[model samples]
Target: MRRALHKWGAAVVVAAGLASGGLVPNAIARTPENPSRVPPVALVTLPPEAQATHKLILAGGPFPYSKDGTVFGNRERLLPLNPRGYYREYTVKTPGLRHRGARRIVCGGTPPTKPDTCYYTSDHYASFQRIAP
Candidate 1:
Protein backbone atom coordinates (compact mmCIF):
# COMPACT_ATOMS: atom_id res chain seq x y z
CA MET A 1 0.00 0.00 0.00
CA ARG A 2 2.81 2.46 0.85
CA ARG A 3 4.71 1.68 -2.43
CA ALA A 4 1.55 2.14 -4.49
CA LEU A 5 0.78 5.49 -2.79
CA HIS A 6 4.29 6.86 -3.50
CA LYS A 7 4.10 5.93 -7.19
CA TRP A 8 0.65 7.51 -7.44
CA GLY A 9 1.91 10.73 -5.86
CA ALA A 10 4.83 10.94 -8.31
CA ALA A 11 2.49 10.43 -11.23
CA VAL A 12 0.23 13.19 -9.90
CA VAL A 13 3.10 15.66 -9.78
CA VAL A 14 4.10 14.87 -13.38
CA ALA A 15 0.51 15.31 -14.53
CA ALA A 16 0.22 18.57 -12.67
CA GLY A 17 3.35 19.97 -14.30
CA LEU A 18 2.08 19.14 -17.78
CA ALA A 19 -1.33 20.64 -17.01
CA SER A 20 0.09 23.94 -15.74
CA GLY A 21 1.02 25.19 -19.21
CA GLY A 22 4.44 24.63 -20.88
CA LEU A 23 6.32 25.96 -17.90
CA VAL A 24 7.98 22.56 -17.52
CA PRO A 25 10.85 20.82 -19.32
CA ASN A 26 10.18 19.00 -22.62
CA ALA A 27 6.87 20.83 -22.98
CA ILE A 28 5.81 22.44 -26.25
CA ALA A 29 6.51 26.16 -26.41
CA ARG A 30 3.59 28.56 -26.31
CA THR A 31 2.92 30.34 -29.56
CA PRO A 32 1.29 33.69 -30.21
CA GLU A 33 -2.44 33.78 -29.53
CA ASN A 34 -3.04 35.85 -32.64
CA PRO A 35 -2.94 34.35 -36.13
CA SER A 36 0.50 35.79 -36.59
CA ARG A 37 1.99 35.15 -40.01
CA VAL A 38 5.45 35.76 -38.58
CA PRO A 39 7.28 34.10 -35.67
CA PRO A 40 8.41 36.02 -32.57
CA VAL A 41 11.88 37.12 -31.43
CA ALA A 42 12.70 37.11 -27.74
CA LEU A 43 14.37 40.41 -26.86
CA VAL A 44 16.82 38.71 -24.51
CA THR A 45 18.57 36.71 -27.28
CA LEU A 46 19.16 39.65 -29.59
CA PRO A 47 22.42 41.62 -29.73
CA PRO A 48 22.92 44.70 -27.56
CA GLU A 49 22.68 47.04 -30.58
CA ALA A 50 19.45 45.41 -31.70
CA GLN A 51 18.07 45.72 -28.17
CA ALA A 52 18.90 49.44 -28.18
CA THR A 53 17.21 49.82 -31.56
CA HIS A 54 14.10 48.11 -30.20
CA LYS A 55 14.02 50.54 -27.31
CA LEU A 56 14.30 53.49 -29.69
CA ILE A 57 11.45 52.15 -31.77
CA LEU A 58 9.18 51.81 -28.73
CA ALA A 59 10.08 55.28 -27.46
CA GLY A 60 9.50 57.05 -30.84
CA GLY A 61 13.11 57.83 -31.48
CA PRO A 62 15.15 60.79 -32.53
CA PHE A 63 17.29 58.22 -34.35
CA PRO A 64 20.90 58.94 -35.28
CA TYR A 65 20.68 57.80 -38.89
CA SER A 66 19.39 60.25 -41.47
CA LYS A 67 17.25 57.49 -42.95
CA ASP A 68 16.32 56.03 -39.61
CA GLY A 69 12.56 56.02 -40.11
CA THR A 70 11.84 55.66 -43.80
CA VAL A 71 9.39 53.53 -45.76
CA PHE A 72 10.70 49.93 -46.25
CA GLY A 73 8.41 49.20 -49.28
CA ASN A 74 8.72 45.38 -48.77
CA ARG A 75 9.98 44.97 -52.34
CA GLU A 76 11.78 41.68 -51.67
CA ARG A 77 8.61 39.99 -50.44
CA LEU A 78 10.71 38.45 -47.66
CA LEU A 79 8.22 39.69 -45.07
CA PRO A 80 4.93 37.80 -44.59
CA LEU A 81 3.45 39.27 -47.83
CA ASN A 82 2.24 42.71 -46.75
CA PRO A 83 1.03 45.42 -49.11
CA ARG A 84 3.06 48.27 -50.51
CA GLY A 85 4.50 50.74 -47.95
CA TYR A 86 3.15 48.64 -45.11
CA TYR A 87 6.66 48.48 -43.70
CA ARG A 88 9.13 51.07 -42.46
CA GLU A 89 12.85 50.55 -41.83
CA TYR A 90 15.11 51.59 -38.99
CA THR A 91 18.88 51.37 -38.70
CA VAL A 92 20.67 49.32 -36.03
CA LYS A 93 23.88 51.20 -35.37
CA THR A 94 26.93 48.96 -35.61
CA PRO A 95 30.01 49.54 -33.53
CA GLY A 96 32.79 51.64 -35.22
CA LEU A 97 30.67 52.04 -38.34
CA ARG A 98 30.56 55.40 -40.11
CA HIS A 99 27.48 54.51 -42.20
CA ARG A 100 24.31 52.46 -41.78
CA GLY A 101 25.19 48.77 -41.44
CA ALA A 102 23.37 45.89 -43.09
CA ARG A 103 21.26 45.25 -40.00
CA ARG A 104 17.80 46.83 -40.04
CA ILE A 105 14.42 46.54 -38.39
CA VAL A 106 11.45 46.64 -40.75
CA CYS A 107 7.98 47.10 -39.31
CA GLY A 108 4.50 47.05 -40.79
CA GLY A 109 1.50 49.36 -40.31
CA THR A 110 0.49 53.00 -40.51
CA PRO A 111 2.24 55.75 -38.47
CA PRO A 112 5.28 53.40 -38.14
CA THR A 113 5.01 53.71 -34.36
CA LYS A 114 2.19 51.15 -34.17
CA PRO A 115 3.26 48.48 -36.63
CA ASP A 116 1.31 45.25 -36.77
CA THR A 117 4.57 43.36 -37.14
CA CYS A 118 8.33 43.86 -37.22
CA TYR A 119 11.26 41.89 -38.71
CA TYR A 120 14.98 41.96 -38.16
CA THR A 121 17.32 41.64 -41.12
CA SER A 122 21.04 41.11 -40.57
CA ASP A 123 21.91 40.24 -44.18
CA HIS A 124 20.59 43.41 -45.82
CA TYR A 125 17.24 41.84 -46.73
CA ALA A 126 18.61 38.59 -48.15
CA SER A 127 16.50 37.17 -45.33
CA PHE A 128 14.40 38.36 -42.42
CA GLN A 129 13.63 37.02 -38.97
CA ARG A 130 10.50 38.12 -37.15
CA ILE A 131 11.26 40.38 -34.21
CA ALA A 132 7.74 41.35 -33.17
CA PRO A 133 4.25 40.02 -33.66
Candidate 2:
Protein backbone atom coordinates (compact mmCIF):
# COMPACT_ATOMS: atom_id res chain seq x y z
CA MET A 1 0.00 0.00 0.00
CA ARG A 2 2.80 2.40 0.80
CA ARG A 3 4.46 1.64 -2.53
CA ALA A 4 1.21 2.27 -4.36
CA LEU A 5 0.79 5.57 -2.59
CA HIS A 6 4.31 6.55 -3.53
CA LYS A 7 3.66 5.86 -7.18
CA TRP A 8 0.47 7.88 -7.08
CA GLY A 9 2.32 10.74 -5.50
CA ALA A 10 5.02 10.51 -8.12
CA ALA A 11 2.41 10.67 -10.87
CA VAL A 12 0.91 13.79 -9.37
CA VAL A 13 4.27 15.50 -9.20
CA VAL A 14 4.97 14.63 -12.81
CA ALA A 15 1.64 16.04 -13.86
CA ALA A 16 2.35 19.22 -11.96
CA GLY A 17 5.77 19.57 -13.55
CA LEU A 18 4.24 19.31 -16.99
CA ALA A 19 1.67 21.89 -16.01
CA SER A 20 4.32 24.12 -14.53
CA GLY A 21 5.17 25.79 -17.81
CA GLY A 22 1.86 26.69 -19.46
CA LEU A 23 -0.63 23.92 -18.88
CA VAL A 24 -2.39 26.29 -16.54
CA PRO A 25 -2.77 29.92 -17.49
CA ASN A 26 -2.51 33.06 -15.39
CA ALA A 27 -6.29 33.38 -15.11
CA ILE A 28 -6.90 29.74 -14.37
CA ALA A 29 -8.94 29.68 -11.21
CA ARG A 30 -8.03 26.76 -8.90
CA THR A 31 -11.47 25.32 -8.57
CA PRO A 32 -12.32 21.69 -9.34
CA GLU A 33 -13.57 22.54 -12.79
CA ASN A 34 -11.77 19.53 -14.17
CA PRO A 35 -10.26 17.34 -11.53
CA SER A 36 -8.23 15.25 -13.97
CA ARG A 37 -6.87 18.29 -15.73
CA VAL A 38 -6.22 20.21 -12.57
CA PRO A 39 -2.55 20.32 -11.68
CA PRO A 40 -1.31 18.86 -8.42
CA VAL A 41 -1.93 21.03 -5.39
CA ALA A 42 1.82 21.44 -4.93
CA LEU A 43 2.43 22.56 -8.50
CA VAL A 44 -0.69 24.48 -9.39
CA THR A 45 1.39 27.11 -11.10
CA LEU A 46 2.01 30.50 -9.53
CA PRO A 47 -0.75 32.96 -8.80
CA PRO A 48 -0.24 36.70 -8.98
CA GLU A 49 0.10 36.90 -5.23
CA ALA A 50 2.70 34.14 -5.24
CA GLN A 51 4.45 35.79 -8.15
CA ALA A 52 4.73 38.98 -6.10
CA THR A 53 6.17 36.99 -3.22
CA HIS A 54 8.75 35.46 -5.56
CA LYS A 55 9.77 38.92 -6.69
CA LEU A 56 10.17 40.11 -3.12
CA ILE A 57 12.20 37.04 -2.13
CA LEU A 58 14.58 37.56 -5.03
CA ALA A 59 14.87 41.25 -4.12
CA GLY A 60 16.13 40.56 -0.56
CA GLY A 61 13.24 42.46 0.87
CA PRO A 62 12.63 44.61 3.85
CA PHE A 63 9.83 42.11 4.35
CA PRO A 64 6.60 43.47 5.71
CA TYR A 65 6.68 40.91 8.50
CA SER A 66 9.55 39.80 10.73
CA LYS A 67 9.65 35.99 10.30
CA ASP A 68 10.25 36.21 6.58
CA GLY A 69 13.71 34.80 5.96
CA THR A 70 13.88 32.31 8.79
CA VAL A 71 15.16 28.81 8.22
CA PHE A 72 12.39 26.50 7.11
CA GLY A 73 12.56 23.09 8.72
CA ASN A 74 10.74 20.98 6.18
CA ARG A 75 9.12 18.87 8.84
CA GLU A 76 6.35 17.87 6.51
CA ARG A 77 8.72 16.44 3.92
CA LEU A 78 6.51 17.84 1.18
CA LEU A 79 9.32 19.67 -0.61
CA PRO A 80 12.19 18.45 -2.79
CA LEU A 81 13.68 16.51 0.11
CA ASN A 82 16.39 18.93 1.24
CA PRO A 83 18.18 18.93 4.54
CA ARG A 84 17.30 21.23 7.41
CA GLY A 85 18.45 24.87 6.97
CA TYR A 86 18.79 24.11 3.29
CA TYR A 87 15.41 25.78 2.90
CA ARG A 88 14.38 29.20 4.10
CA GLU A 89 10.80 30.34 4.08
CA TYR A 90 9.43 33.81 3.37
CA THR A 91 5.97 35.13 4.02
CA VAL A 92 3.79 36.05 1.10
CA LYS A 93 1.64 38.96 2.04
CA THR A 94 -2.05 38.31 1.89
CA PRO A 95 -3.87 41.55 1.18
CA GLY A 96 -5.94 43.00 4.04
CA LEU A 97 -4.61 40.65 6.69
CA ARG A 98 -3.25 41.85 9.98
CA HIS A 99 -0.98 38.81 10.44
CA ARG A 100 1.06 36.51 8.24
CA GLY A 101 -1.23 34.29 6.24
CA ALA A 102 -0.79 30.70 5.13
CA ARG A 103 0.96 31.69 1.92
CA ARG A 104 4.76 31.35 1.90
CA ILE A 105 7.72 31.10 -0.41
CA VAL A 106 10.17 28.35 0.60
CA CYS A 107 13.53 28.77 -1.12
CA GLY A 108 16.42 26.33 -1.16
CA GLY A 109 20.07 27.15 -1.76
CA THR A 110 22.96 29.10 -0.32
CA PRO A 111 23.68 32.60 1.01
CA PRO A 112 19.96 33.53 0.92
CA THR A 113 21.19 36.24 -1.49
CA LYS A 114 20.68 33.73 -4.32
CA PRO A 115 18.71 30.50 -4.35
CA ASP A 116 18.69 27.60 -6.74
CA THR A 117 14.89 27.15 -6.72
CA CYS A 118 11.83 28.27 -4.84
CA TYR A 119 8.40 26.87 -4.12
CA TYR A 120 5.12 28.49 -3.12
CA THR A 121 2.61 27.06 -0.68
CA SER A 122 -0.65 28.90 -0.39
CA ASP A 123 -1.98 26.39 2.10
CA HIS A 124 1.06 26.63 4.30
CA TYR A 125 3.20 23.45 4.34
CA ALA A 126 0.57 21.03 3.18
CA SER A 127 1.85 21.20 -0.38
CA PHE A 128 4.37 23.14 -2.49
CA GLN A 129 4.37 24.37 -6.06
CA ARG A 130 7.69 25.13 -7.72
CA ILE A 131 8.28 28.53 -9.33
CA ALA A 132 11.11 29.88 -11.48
CA PRO A 133 12.31 33.44 -11.97
TM-scores for all candidates?
Answer: 0.66, 0.63
Stretches > 4 Å off in candidate 2: 1-45
Q: Candidate 2 residues 1-133, lDDT tens each?
A: 1111232232222222233453323432222222122224333356667767677777888677789899998765556555779999988878898889899988889978689877777798766666644
Q: Which parts of model 1 are misplaced by more than 4 Å?
A: 1-39
Question: What is the C-alpha local distance difference test score of each model?
Answer: 0.66, 0.65
What local lDDT score does residue 53 receive in model 1, on the 0 to 100 scale?
A: 85
Clashing pairs in 2: 42-129
- Could you list the CA RMSD of all candidates, in the order they appear? 14.0, 10.4
> For this target, which candidate reaches the highest lDDT against the unseen true structure?
1
Among these predicted structures, which one has the highest TM-score? 1
